[model samples]
Target: MAELQIAEIPYEDGGIRYRYARRLSEDGTRWIRDGRFTAYHPNGAIASEGTYSDGIEQGLWRDYHDNGRIAAEGQYDRGQESGVWRYWDSDGRDVNG
Candidate 1:
C-alpha cells in the first residue's frame, strides 16, 4: 500500500481561516493496495474513511456527519454496494437499529 501524504489548501469561512485536505480521488491504481482515504470537515473532524483496491472501493467504508458522527458504514465491491449497511446520525449513533 502506498502512504498517504496530507496537505492543506487555505480557504475562508466566515472570516475564520481554515484549511482542508483536498479531495484525493484520482485514477491511478498501480500504487495503492490496502489503502486508506480520509476527508475532514472544515471544523477539523473526520468526514469519511474507506479502503480501496486498484482504485475501486472494495471493503467497508464509513462516512461521517459534519458533527463528527458516523453517517454511514457499508461494504463495497468494485465500487458497487454489496453487503450489509449501517447508517448513523450526527451524534455517532447508529440509525440502522
Candidate 2:
C-alpha cells in the first residue's frame, strides 16, 4: 500500500478564498482521496467535512454555514447520500422541525 499523503489546496473565486484539504493515496496510477476530507468556505469557516474511502465519500458528513453554524449533516455511502439527513437554517434553527 502506498503511503497516504495529505494535500491542501486553496482556491479563489471572485476574490473569495476557498480551501480543500484531503488525504490522498497513490493507487499505482494516480492519487485518490482515501481518508478525511474537509473544505473551507470563502470566509475560512468549515464548509463541509467528511471521510472518504477509495476516493468515494463514506460515513458521516457535515456542512456548515458561513456564520459558523451547522447547515446540514448526514451519512454517505459510496459517495451517495444515505440514511437520515438533518438541516439547519443559517441562524442555527432546525429546518426540519
Query: For model 1, where is the 10-residue window of minimal lDDT?
Result: 14-23
lDDT of 2 by residue, 1-97 (tens): 6677777776655432433334434446667787888888877888898888888989999999989999999999998999999999999899886
lDDT of 2: 0.80
TM-score of each: 0.61, 0.83
Candidate 2: residue pairs that collide: none
Candidate 1 colliding pairs, count: 0
Per-residue error (Å), model 2, residue 71: 0.4
Segments of candidate 1 deviating more than 4 angstroms = 1-34
- Please provide the root mean square deviation of candidate 1 (C-alpha atoms, Å): 5.8
**1-97 per-residue lDDT for model 1 (tens digits):** 3455444433356322222222333655333334566666777677777776655777888888878767998899998998888887787666786
